[model samples]
Target: MSEPPVSYKRHRFPPQIIAHAVWLYFRFPLSLRLVEKLLLERGIVVSYETVRVWAHKFGPDYVRCLRRKKPSRQDIWHLDEVVVTINSEKRYLWRAVDQDGYVLDEIVQIRRDTRAAKRLLERLLCKQGCPPKRMITDKLGSYGAARRKIMPKVEHCQHKGLNNRAENSHVPIRKRERAMQGFRSWSGLQRFVETFPAVRNHVVPPHSHRSAFATHLHRLAAMAEWKSVTLTAA
Candidate 1:
């Protein structure tokens, strides 16, 4: 006889707990331990290690699933790179976000040269399946080289203050990094930032006429659809 199908239930932490934990990590720049302490005060006894694991595992998955069901529309992309210290060594973190602050792609590389920029752009284009109408970057000459080779037709603009949008988007990530004691490895940094955008996008409502309640309802509905689709695919 065929085995019975397994049932996977959602986590038992109240929606408030899950939401609060995610909010604290993404919004306020709190360490997993700090968040664990806060939850304990509310009578929940989860461990900080568990919180870190949850943030690493479910955080990005949740964000991706949420976006898959309700994809954002962004035709313009702003790309930038930031230097971060990992394991006492300096590394580069490449980030791409839309004009509306939706994170599109992120990666970590050991170098910040033309090759690194090209790799980051290629990965972003492959995932996004096309170039944005316009790409904005700072005065970095490497950006010019990458754009010329990969997205020749796409407008590349480099001017003072023009790339601030992408630069400003890094602030939240910096805050989060400071709270978590900075990343220890390039892999860890890449994974966390990759997941960070999705979580951030989930809490932001699209610019539309929908009420906050309506937006929440839509997000919940999308989450349900994502769960069903993921289970079936699995």
Candidate 2:
């Protein structure tokens, strides 16, 4: 048989601690130093650099595993982009989400044009395995051009109000940018953005018309799912 997961092999810290550190860094809008200080209060003496290394090393794997555990997405998709300034350079962060506010995929680019929109659509198609019944976007001509070229049959609604779902999704990333004081490099930014939404999708449950007990049970299930996904390779 193949060896068991090496989540903690040769590491000074246990898998639980390392996983917790990675979780804290991505799950919340906390900086590496803050994560270190929080752990220090708990008697863990990990440095901020160690936490940074742990995030870059483990975050992508965790997100990939988490995505594998998600259910099939909706037929309606929302796409949008926001400007992220790093070291005085402006970049575009393209994001796509389903009708129920579940993040599907995101990417970073220096240009916001038909090409960028097509790139996002292609990534969505490859990952989602199908085009949506309809897609909503702001009054961006690039989205119109790209949608026509790629998924021409998928209804493209270009309305400001109609794309609020996608626009609203940027709020969290904007908050994160402030916490980290903006990303230093495009490659580094892309790496974290790609993984962050998957983790968010795993932890967040759809809002319910059901009772509080049902919500609590769902949260318990989400927590259990998180542990199982993280330990799959451990």
Candidate 3:
């Protein structure tokens, strides 16, 4: 007996619009309503609700695709935490980034204790699967404990002033938070942070390189190839 055929319904907006909407959502800290207004100004008539739906569906998918295409791995990793107030409660966002300032992973949790830190580290290790040769962090005791548990062989460097790379990397996210009025939920915060890093890595040129039109084109082309390979691999 033959199996029944499957049918897929096409979305109303073209792939371009869907891609554009997802980019806007992460590229800036704008809310869905603001994005819809901006699109209206650009002569694209789409509702804010539709924009929200598009972001929830396609934003992470795009980021995942980009990650798969880029095979470079971080050898040295930096870990840190930042405080974010959501709905009158203070929460901590645990973040890990490579030496080049590319975010590896992030998790927002209610507490910044050893348990939370350990969980975050485990998640990061599991996702990237490449243990850093050197881990840089501030004088946070939890980091010491977490490092010992997950990466016993890796050197853990803790000091007051040495982890500046990780500290400085939070500036972009801080700026983004100011524009969006803070994230409303833990899951939302995680999704946004995870997606933002890939977008930033794609658009921003290496610090040592000169920024020019040609450089911008090259970065974008590299990003396109990265995404293609990643999606195909997945």
Error of 2 at 214 (Å): 2.8
Worst 10 residues of 2 by lDDT: 65-74
The candidate with the higher lDDT, 2 or 3, is 2
lDDT of each: 0.74, 0.83, 0.75
Writing each residue's lDDT as its tens digit, candidate 2 over 47-80 gives 9999999999888877665534333534788899
Strongest candidate by lDDT: 2
Mark the regions of model 1 whose C-alpha exceeds 4 Å error after superposition: 1-23, 68-74, 206-234
| 48 Cα displacement, candidate 3 (Å) | 1.8
Give one digit per residue, the lDDT tens place, for model 3 in 118-146. 99878977887677778899998999998
TM-score per model over all chains: 0.78, 0.92, 0.84
Query: Where's the lowest-lDDT run of ten residues in candidate 1?
Result: 65-74
